[model samples]
Target: MLRIGLVGIGFMGRVHMLSFTDKPMIPNAYVKNGKLVAVCDIDSKKLEQAKKEIPSLEIFSDYKEMLASGKVDAVIIATPHYLHPLMGIEALKNKIPVLIEKPVGVFTKNVFELNEVASQNPDVVFGLLFNQRTNPFFVKAKEIIDNDGIGKLKRMNWMITNWYRPQKYYDNGSWRGTWAGEGGGVLMNQAPHQIDLWQWLCGMPTKVRAYCKFGKNRNVEVETDVTAYVEYPDGGSGVFVTSTHDAPGTNRLELIGNNGKIVIENEILSYKKLLVPENKLNETATANLMDPKNAPQFEEVIYTKKELGDIPWGVEHAITIENWINTIEGKEELIAPGIEGVKALELINSMLLSTFLDKEIELPIDSNKYYEELMKKCEKSEFKDTWRV
Candidate 1:
């Protein structure tokens, strides 16, 4: 059995721990050939609670000690946003397989460093917990896209404002909305999964121009609302609008391509496949806009959750964790490799950088410049390290 060590007993940490248990917190979500052998957290109260929940569990106050103790064959870092890369780097250097929670790091620079270390430690499995990748709707969307069902993507738009958070939520944790602690508001915290999925399905954009509102309808220092415009390499453009302020919010993704259109909303995937390519129709139409021949025919298909079976919340996290363990055992390849985590991070940083500079920022942004700006925000953050414990 793979002995796993988990760091950070925060909300996500606790959830991850449940996956390795004999009975998972979520239905049909238990892992095989792995068990959480040890847990590390700086919070004494949290550790005490964990010890009570897990009998005969090895606990540590320092993650480095946990890594060096030889009690765990692998480690999972579910710490704060900024600590992800740092902890991942340490684990990789120790030649321990690691699975890190999302957003990789606050900035691409640090994540790049982590990626470099992971590259050097080729044998060690480096996985990322991008659980939403396992969602059937998204999985189907990817399959359709890869199969050229939506030939030559022309445009994409995601209005994912369903991540509503109240002021009390941010107020509960000192690090929740701060630059030094959480790194970003919606982009870093609530929307990383969708942002990762955006790139995963639609591919990375070449340029990004964004408008962000900090503390909009919320008392957070980081952006709570954002509207970003992006340009793909093929001259295609897309828009990403997100906020934690919308109530009964909207979660819709629409993609328009040369051959068809795809939409995912309310857990349903809708595809309108055109009988003739739009470009071809545009070039060969026999009549004016009112002509019957000019009107394109579409074969629409809708995929629903009922057809796919109801996937319980938090089950995807367990699936990802199990995939990580399987990868470590050479039983399966990782669904979300840790290195690909950088793409989503780059998108997050680019959108924030665009808003910061009030211009369209290019992909593979100047990491140094973004880091410099991020540090400025970190320097001004009022959050104290003591508050974390």
Candidate 2:
């Protein structure tokens, strides 16, 4: 069996630990070939609690000690945002496979450096916990796009604001909503999955112009609301809007292409396929501007939650963990490679940088410039008791 060591026995750490057991909290989904052999954390109380939960499990106060003890074949990092790349680098240097939680690092520079180390250790199974990738609807959307069901993307819009967090949620942890602690607000915390899926399905934008509201109706120092306009390489454009304060919030994604349009909202996928490509109609149409003959012919198909059987809540998290363990055992490939984590980081960093500089930021952003800006915020940040690796 694959021996898995988990770092940072916090909320997400506990969630990952659940998946390693035969009887996971999420029924019918567990890592069959792996077990949580060791756990490391700074909190003695959490370590004691973990020991109580798994009496046979080894516990450590220092992660480096755990990595050096040779008790675990792999490590899963569930630490804070800033420590992700640092711990990942340490694990890679120790030649241990690692699965990291999302938004790989606070900024692109650190993530790029982590990717560099990951590239050097090509044989290591480095993965990221982007659990939303396991959703059947998203997988099906990817299939349709890859098969040219939606030809030549023209526009994309995703307004995902369903991740509503109350003030008490932020107040629960010292490192919850501060810039020095958790990095950005909704983009870094709540919307990284959607941003990943956005770029995963529609591709990255070449330029981004964003407007953000920092501490908007929230007692935090980071952005709570954001609206960004992006331009693609093919002259295509897109918009992304997200927030953590919108109640009765919306989760919608619309993709318009040359041959069809796809709308995913309310756990349903609505696809409209045109009989003739829009460009073809534009070029060959002989009818008058308002003629009925010029009307477009199309077919619509709707896919609902009923199409996909009962998926227990939070099961995808276990599924992602299983995929990582399988990849380590050479049974399958990684679904969310650690290197791809940088794309979403770059996109979010660009959005914040755009809001910071009040201008449109281009792709392949100046990482040094962004780092400098982030450091300025860090220097002024009030949350100084942030976790360190």
Candidate 3:
């Protein structure tokens, strides 16, 4: 069996642990050749609680000790945002297979360093817990886009505000909304999945100009609301907007191309396929007074993928874990490789950098300069309860 170790016993760690159990949420998933052999957390009380829930489970207060004891064949780093890269690099250097949690890291420089260590250990498997990649709707979207179904993208817009968090949520954790701790607000936590999906489906933009509001409605130092405009190299453009304060929030993505359009919202994927490509009609139109307004009508198809379950987060995460196990056994390929984690991080940093400098930021950003800017913010960080535990 693939003896797996899980680091971090907080919210995500608990969610990861449940996927390994006989929970009904993941009825279709199980690690056939692997099991959770050990768990590590800095919080002793959390470790104690974990032992109560998992009687036969091994526990560790220090991750390094667990790594050195050779108790686990692989590990899942589910710690906070800042710990992903640090713990990932340590696990990779030890020649241990690792599946790191999202955004890879708060910044590109650190994630790049972790990736360098992973590259050095080619045999060791590396994956990221970008579980949303397993969602059928997103999978279908990627297939359609890759097949040129949308043909020469012109514009894309995604306004995802379903991530609503109250002041109490941030008040409970001192590190929740600070630059020195969580790195960012909505972009880092609530929107990593959307950000990753954005690049995964639409590709990274060439430049980004963003406006962000810090502590807009919440009592936090990082951005709680953001609106960003992006440009692609092929002249295509996009608009992204998100907020944690909008109730009855919206989660919609619309993609327009020369041939057709796609709109995904409320777990449904709809497409409008053009009979004659727009560009072709634009060039060969016979009428001088009017544009080509006639095109074959297409029906809207709803894609529920009921087999994937109604609650996507838990189900998709379970699928990701199963895929990771099979990949380690040479049975399948990873849907979300850890290295691709940098793409979303770059997008996050770019948007935030644009907000900080009040101008458009270019892609493949200057990592050192961003890091320098971040450290300056870190120095002046004024979060009162900055996570002493």
lDDT of each: 0.90, 0.89, 0.85
The all-Cα superposition gives candidate 1 an RMSD in Å to the true structure of: 1.9
Question: Which 10-residue window of candidate 2 scores lowest in summed lDDT?
Answer: 280-289
Candidate 3, which ten residues in sequence have the lowest lDDT sum?
290-299
lDDT at 308 for candidate 2?
A: 56
lDDT per residue as tens, model 2, 1-389: 88899999888888777777665666776766788999999999999988988888999999999999999999999988899999999999999999999879999988889999999999998999999988878887888899899899999999988889999999998778888888889999999999999999989899999998999989989999999999999988999999999998999999998899899987899889999887777645645657767777788989888875445556888888888989988889999999999999999999999999999999999999998998888778778875422
The root-mean-square deviation over C-alpha atoms between each candidate and the true structure, in angstroms, is: 1.9, 1.7, 2.6
Best by lDDT: 1
Give the lDDT ranking, best first: 1, 2, 3
Worst 10 residues of 1 by lDDT: 380-389
Listed per model in order, the count of residue pairs whose N, CA or C atoms clash below 3 Å is: 0, 0, 0
Encode model 1's per-residue lDDT on 176-225: one tens digit a residue.
89987887899999999999999999999989999988889998889999
What TM-score should be assigned to candidate 2? 0.96
Give residue 71's error in model 3 in angstroms.
Answer: 1.0
